[model samples]
Target: MKVDNSAIHHSPVAVSGGTLLAALAVAIFSFTFPATHWALGGFGPWTTVTVRAALAAAIAGPCLLAARAPLPDRRQWPAIAVVASGVVLGYPLLTTLALQTTSTSHAAVVVGALPLATAAIASVVTHTRHPRLFWIAACSGTVVVIVFALSQSHGAPTGGDLLLFASLLICAAGYVAGGRLARTMPGWQVIGWALVAALPLTGPAAALALGVEPSRPGGLSVLGLVYLAAVSQFGGLMVWYRGMAAIGVARASQLQLAQPLLTLVWSALLLGERLGAATPLTAVAVLVCVAVTQRV
Candidate 1:
């Protein structure tokens, strides 16, 4: 009897490719808070969120059209709506608002719990169980992040912290839905359709915000706005959903444990935020947990 061994050979390659894609997505997302800070230098929170979504929709719309992508079936619309509400609208609005009140570094640390939230939500939505070790590692990372957040905030949850937490839940839900949908369709299409679905709301909101909000529109701010729309909103998620589909959602989410650390670096470099001594310690702890979760 001849043994195929083809799947055995390909499994590692597939996993490696997925990990790389997810890590790249994390790299792209790590710039988001800093970019939002720059965007806010010119645009109000409402304008920043609405305009970014609208711009992303504008970009995605043309790509979908050019690709001749068929419209998603009626059954898919509900999931797409969830994706639009959670990621396209809710997450950006909440995070942008939170950034108004909090320093970018503080907000970035607080959002470190996102990986745990994503994994937990993915478990529920995908009806999959992770090993006890996986949960242990994930929980450890979350606890470290929470402690750092508390220390940074002087032991109280500020309004910004609350908003960031809310964003976490909604974004996780959107991620799980998008990941699930990616199994059936192209990952890019998942986000493309979600962006297009959000056009009705985002388009009007953008117009209203531009009129109501004071806009400065410096070179850096304009660059930031464009990055948020083009990369953070559309490009990053395109690969992220693909990675989630390749790896299980729970596994893919654990990769984001490094995102906050990356964000911290960006904050310091881009916004001139000073890092506290605790940051290094927190980075080590988070990385350890990330490694364990990936291994287990």
Candidate 2:
């Protein structure tokens, strides 16, 4: 089978489009966590996840075939499985569970921790060397996020707080492993096989979820679910993995810090959520800190 090496290697347009698409994907993904939380006012966490993943698989499957993306080899399967479990399934599930009670703003802050978490985990497992500035930036970003989160504590259990934290940890692991796989496979192929690997779980999870009476999802709610599945999971991931392949995982992770701000925009538009007086100032600080890491 002939692969499109040109698309993979030499196309500047593909690379630029991939990067933009990845950013858009993250933006759309940020919306879904909050939207899913809203939807869960009507659906179970497992149900929301199952439906979302099913939609993503449906969209991604045909695209993978058209692209002639290769299936995972024996050696590649382990890494693929790791990402499937950690990212495709674990991240969404945790986020879904977390959003049930946590505010979207809080969820966004927790999700922002992803870049820092990715840096820490990758340093430990991959023998990758990053400059001191990177560590400083990563730690600074974490502190900024935590300060904002604790300052606004609602003094109640929103399942989202803990779940989002767990999701970030798992997602960081997936990013590190997925980067290694992307070195050998096309970005789309890594996601395609990993999605397949995750099917055994996603399939059963969706089926069990189907047993419930789906709440009357509004037009916006339905649209949000579809966006999460098709855009974020399928399209966004394709571009993100490509970015991961282009720049190493640790470097590519800098993109994630943008997620919180982007998400705040979506929340304001959709849910009438406003940024706190300090939100913007703190966001700038976080961005600067994350930018410092990119210099590393």
Candidate 3:
């Protein structure tokens, strides 16, 4: 479902706050792949995915109840399912699998096309037309990501590449659907509701994982898992949905062009990936395209 563009128009201050929230959310999200990379040393991808979701649901459900949030109406259920599946399930499951083989640096660049994917999702959902400049800018940013991958991997594609791309695509779909839902309810509440909706699946899976997996992972690995569940799965989406709701999907998603750059920094610091001189320049160019797209 798409929100009417006219309905989402907000005051300047609101939009600015949304932008800042989006930035904060992206910062939190950028840690996920790197954290997963480390956590995989101790936990299986399925284990990580299920356990994190279940933990998130624990927090989300209680918060929703405490706030006295209204349950979504019948019409909203389908959209909530899409939001829950894509963001809460699909993205984490795929990326956690991918990171077992892929470096965080590689994951960051491949997932860099998120803004373009988001715009494409938005176009389909809203059935809205953009100017010629917007299309050019959107495609240009994607091209830069492709070129970056080639330069990094010596033009070779890996299984992880496909998985991460799929993750980004699913995430873009969730972003669009969640953005639409956020217009009707509080943005944060959409994620909380989605988390609760996921409990039947996640809760059982998490219990099974805990039963089989070793209880004593290293401190860093434990920290990574907690971060993924608490911040990446729950907290980040709260702000991201609000931002998208405030600024409209097309414009706010463009802000995601900045995510990969932040992710790269995380990768370098946490995963020991080299932040080569070439990377920053390419990031700047892609961001310019994002800026242009937002304007057009």
- What TM-score, computed on C-alpha atoms, does each candidate reach? 0.91, 0.85, 0.91
Whole-model lDDT per candidate: 0.85, 0.72, 0.83
Best by lDDT: 1
Q: Look at candidate 1 and give me any clashing residue pairs.
A: none
Q: What is the alpha-carbon lDDT for the whole of candidate 1?
A: 0.85
Reference-based TM-score, model 3: 0.91
Q: Write the per-residue lDDT of candidate 3 for residues 157-273, one digit (tens) a residue.
A: 577777887887898888889999999998889999998999999999888987887655788878899988899889999998988788777767767777888888888877788
Candidate 2: where are CA atoms >4 Å away?
1-18, 66-68, 154-159
Worst 10 residues of 1 by lDDT: 1-10
The runs of at least 3 residues in candidate 3 whose Cα sits more than 4 Å from the true structure, single-residue gaps closed, are: 1-8, 150-154, 212-216
Candidate 1 residues lying further than 4 Å off, grouped into runs, are: 1-14
Q: What tens-digit string does per-residue lDDT give for candidate 2 at 1-296?
A: 22113235636765666566556656666666666656676566777788778777767678778988766668888898888887788998898777776777667766777877877887777666777787878888888877776666654334556677788889889877887687788777777777766777787878888786566677766766776777667666777787677655654666676887877777778777777777766777777787777666
RMSD per candidate (Å) reads 4.0, 4.7, 2.5
